[model samples]
Target: MLRLQSALGIFALLLLAFALAENRRAVSLRQAAIGLVATFATAILLMKVPVVARAFGAINDAVGAISAASRAGSSFVFGYVGGGALPFDLKVPGADFILAFQALPIVLVMSVLTTLLFYWRVLPPIVRGMAWLLERTLGVGGAVGLSTAANIFLGMVEAPLFVRPYLSQMSRSELFLVMTGGMAGIAGTVLVLYATLLAPLIPDAAAHFVIASVLGAPAAILVSLIMVPETSVRRTGGTLEDPEMEVASTMDAIVKGTGAGIELLINIVAMLLVLVALVYLVNAMLGLLPNVGGAAISLQRLLGLVMAPVCWLMGLPWDQAVTAGSLMGTKTVLNELIAYVDFSKLPADALDPRSRLIMLYAMCGFANFASLGIMIGGLGVMAPERREEINALGLKSIVSGTLTTCLMGAVVGVLS
Candidate 1:
């Protein structure tokens, strides 16, 4: 009975997308069916099948090893202050320190490793295979397909570069998909860091993150197609050409990758500082208001009020819905970083196991206000002519991206 209710909820969300579609008449039922089935099958396989579960367990073990390696580098450079082993008795847990030093360094290391893998031609075949899968399943042009697949591994800005040449020629729907795909999944650089933050709160954290990204790819397609159906007839059905960014050699790739990682690291730290401070200020003001339920009203409470309905729709039990909703609200308004930070602090008894798992899939994405700005700026500079279009679609992309994550959460809710 619960599964049936969850399935109905998922259908309603899809219908909501259809109602908001730019060209309702252009919505392709065939494409939508394919995407939905593929997404469902992939999620079930990754999260449930015994053989696949074992593989994900191995992946989780690998992520643990990588986290340790990243900490080794962080310790060597920043000492005990950055989660490194030290002889002194600070007696503080590693999670207590500034995230920039302790967590963001993982991003840098992952970036370098990702670059090396690409330089050695290790990632291209896999990327192409995934792209091929999406293309064959959705009947999308190669360029759109490739960019969507690349988003699973690359950041929003970097993923579109693979299909840069096709951007100008892409139809409105294709462009929408490109942007939607970028926002729907996170970059590889920070996947491990997120997995680590979530490790204590959820089991198989690394595997869940991986599954969310993979499953979210198809969900994004389905959501994008429904919300912004392909009405334009122009199709750039060309095959993907390997995009070459200038890296003189292996050493150069490492240097460039590190530099890029530093830029991302600084950006994350700055955004978190400002956004967190803003949230504090707002909460302080809100504290002046009358208490609710014998406790002073807070930003968290307000967000919970706003998102609780959506969470309930996603099939969360009413008791856990508000807490999970607050997390989703935080992710949308502030960013997933602070959202994850807050989620890690939730008391074990505050939520049941099922709701906790649902939130895991929900919060895994780059869809937030800050990301919208970054996408506009990054993709704007890449293709100056499309800047207006990028700006125009920015808000809609956020909606589609948020819906994609919720859609994934809904699927998990049904299956669980």
Candidate 2:
């Protein structure tokens, strides 16, 4: 029964993907057929292939190492003299810090590592190689294609830097593609953090996070193409650009990267602190309202009501659907980091195994409201002439990107 349900879920996801594409172009039976085949191929590569699996393993190891180091640092700072020990004894006091487990340190280390790999010309080729394959099969442009591929490792904002020279020249469809790609995949830095947060809740979460990143790449491309089909525009042949020599010496890159990481760490910690407090304040306000069903109407519950149907469509069981939907709502309205924190706090039996896995994949993107503003501001700076277009498309891109990741989750759920 599960197998049958899974197969049906995959079919539904493909149909939905094509339906989204049809909004932009006439749904050619031929194109739909091709897209379905390509979608399955992507899923297979991400989930089934041995080499790809091995690569994900390598990435997971790197993330795990960084997470361990961060936890060690957190322990040193909080568990040591200045930091007070917890009333309830735990092995690592820093592990109690919500942000610490999210692998902030891993992100810092990966940023420097990725920079070093780029400088050595090792990573771009692999990115370009994947881009070439995608272009050959999916018929996307070089700049958009490369940007989408690079998004697997870099953040949406950072990926644009790889093709920084082309933003001003890209057409509406290409611009949408880039934005969608950014929204779909997360920065490598955050992946480790999420892994650590989820590890305790979901077994093998680090491995799952790595798979989500890779799987998200093609899904982003597909959904973006659907949202804005390639109309009449100059078709640029896809080619991988040579990585620029290190901006500074290797040591300089490390120092700068680490400095940048420190800033990110500080920003994340501050944001989490403020957001968590804000949520509490909001909940308190809601508590002032008259009780409904013997409890005050809270924001999270309201979001859950709005999102339950969407979760159901993703094939989550009814019992767990509301919980999953609420998390998605939190992610969309607030931010993923906050949503993950909320998810971590849920009671042990609140969600079943399948639902938990599905939610992990669904929440794995930068599709929140905050990201919308960031995209507009960031891209506007890069291509001021297209600022209006970026702003107009911002909301649509978020919906499309969030839906794309959710669709990937559905596909995975089916396969599982």
Candidate 3:
């Protein structure tokens, strides 16, 4: 029965992809069929390939190192905050300081490493290889294909750099595909941070984070192609331009990348501080309202009500469906970081292992209100003529992207 349910979920996802392509003149049934098969095949590679699995293990080790470093720094500042010499001990009850301050350093280091990899031309080949496959299988233009592939590792703004020259010339459907891809996957820097964040709760979280990244890649491609098929004049046979390393020499690259990573680290810490405080404020305000069933009707609760059905569809047990639903809603309406924070705060035994794993895969992306601003600013700056198009597609991209990740989560649940 579970296998049948899993098959049904995969079929529904493919049908959704096909529907998105239906509007395009170039997207024949044959093309859509090929694209769907390719996506499934890629999903299998991400899950089963030994090389890919080992790469994820490396990422996990990096995350663990960062976590250890952060803990060392935290110990220096707040001695015994977690009832030990460590800055924040995971074994200590109610010790969220590690998450609040320490986890971001991993993002910083990963960002610098990512820049260095790009400088050496190591990353582009992998991105271009994925783009080539997407292009050949889906019949997408090169620019769109590369941008979507690049998005798996880089942010929405950064991915566009791969196809910067063609931004102004890209058709509306292509632009939408780019936007949808951005919303679907997360930056590599943040992936490490999230791995550390959930390590305490979810076993093998590092591997899961890596799998989520790869799985989200094709999921983004399929969803974007579905929402807006390639219908306009297609540019043919253009190769992907290499990403800029933004440095003059190897030493320069290292220094500059490190500096940029510091800035990113600071921004992440500040954002978390502000967003967490804002949630508290909102909850306090809601607490003033009359209580229902001895609990105040807060935003999280409201979100849970709205998203519970979706969570159940993803195969969460009944006891945990609402909690998982609330997290999903928070991720969509607020941000993934906040949702993960909430997930971390849940009581032990609140969710079984399976549901927890499912939510981790589901929430690993950049789909949120902030990303709209990012899309508008990043794409708008690149192609001023398409500013309106960027704005119009922002909300839909978020919707489609969130739906795509959820679809993947449903599939993962069935597999499990």
TM-score of each: 0.76, 0.72, 0.71
Per-residue lDDT, model 3, residue 272, is 45
Candidate 2 lDDT tens digits, 100-149:
44334444665566567666666666655655676677766677777776
lDDT value, residue 221 of candidate 1: 87
The most accurate candidate by lDDT is 1
Candidate with best TM-score: 1
Off by over 4 Å in 1: 53-133, 234-236, 239-300
lDDT of 3 by residue, 1-416 (tens): 64455456666655655564546555556655565566667667776675887776675565456446656655556555521354433684335445434444444444456567667776667655755665666767666777776666666766665565467767777788788888888776466667777999998787777777767766776677666776766652246566454567778767876676565455545544665567668878999999987888777678778777666667776678888888887887677877887888899888888778878877888877656655665566557798898888877887778777877787677767
* Residue pairs in candidate 1 whose N, alpha carbon or C atoms collide under 3 angstroms: none
lDDT of model 2 at residue 171? 77
Considering only N, C-alpha and C atoms within 3 Å, which residue pairs clash in candidate 2? 102-193, 103-193, 107-189
Once superposed on the true structure, which residue ranges of model 3 sit more than 4 Å away at CA? 12-29, 56-132, 236-300
User: Which segments of candidate 2 are over 4 A away from where they belong?
Assistant: 2-23, 26-32, 49-51, 57-131, 234-236, 239-302
